[model samples]
Target: MNDFWQQCSTLLEQELPSQQYQTWIKPLSLLEFDIEASTLHIAAPNRFKLDWVKSQFSSRIADLARDFCCKPMVVHFVLDPKVARRANGATMAGSVDSASVQLAAAADLTAQITSLNSTTSETSIGQQKNSAAAGSGWSGSPLTNHESSGAPERSKLNPVLTFENFVTGKANQLARAAAIQVADNPAVSYNPLFLYGGVGLGKTHLIHAIGNQLRQQKVGARIRYIHAEQYVSDVVKAYQRKAFDEFKRYYHSLDLLLIDDIQFFSGKSRTQEEFFYAFEALVANKAQVIITSDTYPKEISGIDDRLISRFDSGLTVAVEPPELEMRVAILLRKAHSEGVDLSEDVAFFVAKHLRSNVRELEGALRKILAYAKFHGREITIELTKEALKDLLTVQNRQISVDNIQKTVADRYGIKIADMYSKKRPADIARARQIAMYLAKELTQKSLPEIGELFGGRDHTTVLHAVRKIADVRSKDALLNRELHVLEQTLKG
Candidate 1:
């Protein structure tokens, strides 16, 4: 099992970039392995890395284990330093402190020992301070596979959503300040910070920035951040496997808990019970608990009253949808990260049209850039308009039946006549129905117009065709891709 872990580490080193390996992978120690139980025990430097690896890379590691050792593997992550030291007793002897370990050779046996034994004392205080300073500017780190037993899977939080990237607008300014204060002095300003916002607002980013700051300040600090959906899923999994005690123990031990999308637990009674206990445990211990939800605590219907009251105990902050200027700033920042040079005009145009969300703004930019690169065109107003025409049209206008028939027939190498012909063939029917649905989407033409276009069929017939095509498209990836391409072609 140790050899397998070493091999897994080598593979991870090859897979992740050097910088990411240094930040996230270097701090992990393989504490124990249970080959008979197919479990691998791992010690994470902090809870954030532990959640990240479990969320993003556990399955990848499991697949690797199967490939390398012909055995199934489960990862058990222990964030406790004492547990790690005890489990890897032989490996920890004579290991230098983590600060003294060289970057390239940090995975050496000596370094592992040092990492397991390092403490939050005066001798390590300077290193912790430096790490905290580094984290304030750090973006994100890569994930690694450590062993754990049936632990809840982890989710990846974007590293770039740090304090630096978060633009301080009037809407989120107070929340930003409060979050900063909390990060600077955890469990001091807001014991249970409640941040609520619509999608793509900076709630998750702010929470992560706080966690990053805390980890940097105190390397031994325990921070556990997860999506509420994950908490619910863990509850379900625990109930199924009768491991409820372990589940509670896992969350109750956290020094800080950041739960995203807390609204997801609104109606889940059992999960809410588990979460309530976890919430109270952390709060009682004076651990910082930050939560993000789509709606305010009062507005989130179906949540237990006790849970809602607990959520409202701390300072409540809301991140409003970004205004025009803020949107432009976000675009500029995103463009900078992507190494794309965006003129003020281009950024303004994108921000004006893609006001749906920040993610949409970035997606539009990516699409436009991709289209420009693919066609060897300069990034200009005309190019941007053309590149985004399809998406914009779908967002604003409907497609006609004639348009759908024409687009589908052209794409499938079949004639429009063949679509209406008495051929009950599989391919022809599929094409004909797709044409009917496209007409429904691309044009203002009525269902009768669509039906008449396809062999004088009835409006109801067009409706049925549309429904059938939609059902097929949902399950068929190739069909979905083809439809997307057709949409792009028509709109562009």
Candidate 2:
């Protein structure tokens, strides 16, 4: 049984991401196997891991058992409560700390979810100088997985939303790096750490990660992670209850404040006033504050100019849509967590059609998984097509090089004739390159064909344009935004 489990682990290492294997597979132990009954028993370190292993690895392990026993087998996973009692003895307690492999492999991936653990550093908050937090019901102990701080006020942070689990790519590298720096240094690094992006672009995940990291590092630091809507509600309740003093004390004394979807504060005058006071108080005391929104701080309408200026004062990073390769990695990681092996071709098919955000890409993957399981069929390109025919139909519009050239030209205030003519001016050349890049990205045309469409230029010229735009888009925020808008326009 032990040998069988090891073989299964080895096999899975080949099929799943390395982080998935280390985080989910290494902790499992084989307890028993009944040859005649074809039953295999597996032990996980704790309940959290037991459930995850059962859902994410049981099927694959059962397949290995079948191979080992020369027949079908049922894989059963359970937690040893004894192991749970001995924190040092459990595999989970050592999950992030014990692995011999360097974690940079996992850290480089931008993502969403619970980080396996945090890389903690120095704290800037003085040790509980504000006694008002205790009286205002804001003081709390450090958090443990699945359990709150055991104080009157709950932070409402998901224990599983950490940095280790987030898969990173070109799309969110800057945002993730800034989040880590804030997590490690707290008030000293990126005081506000303004994260802006479209919906479901991992802004909430990154903010939660910062809070969780702070909780682990800064003992007795008052921390709160709340949505803008919830903050508004709290303001309303305080007004009704005449508890403004308590609210002020509670909000102003926090060592770390993580607020999500700040756009929700727009048009709410009272909430804005309250939050402004809290923000000013925290910043004055050198406490960390992190905010997330659907757009840049300057573009967030209905907010005060003073508040906007304050928001822009800190480090602001946009979490853009994950690129193609990043989208595929996300799909594979998600499937691996669900105990399925999704092939690259099918991932590419789904990724190409759902290019807006991580949430939509995940929705597409879930549909395909559900459709396959419902019909008792293998997941393949054909099955993916059948599952997402509606999405495919919506995205099936043909975007040609001519259309791209015209679109880019109009947007950049250049003539379409310049796309084919030898126009070397910076604006015209830039627009031409952008059009070529879009043509390659949104259409199925070959490089040579795309080149020929632009005044019979060589394939290398087209390739150079694609490479230049791709490289620039990652580093240049303005150009990245322009490309993002153009792609959306063409797709829409």
Global CA lDDT computed for model 1: 0.66
How many clashes show up in model 2? Answer: 12
What is the TM-score (0 to 1) of candidate 2? 0.68
- State model 2's lDDT: 0.74
Residue-wise C-alpha lDDT for candidate 2, range 356-433, written one tens digit per residue? 789988899999999999999878778889999998777666466788898899999999899999969999999999
The lDDT leader among the candidates is: 2
Model 2: residues with Cα > 4 Å off, grouped in runs: 1-155, 398-403, 442-446, 487-492
In order of appearance, the predictions have TM-scores of 0.51, 0.68
For candidate 2, the per-residue lDDT at 460 reads 66
Task: Report backbone clashes per prediction.
Answer: 22, 12
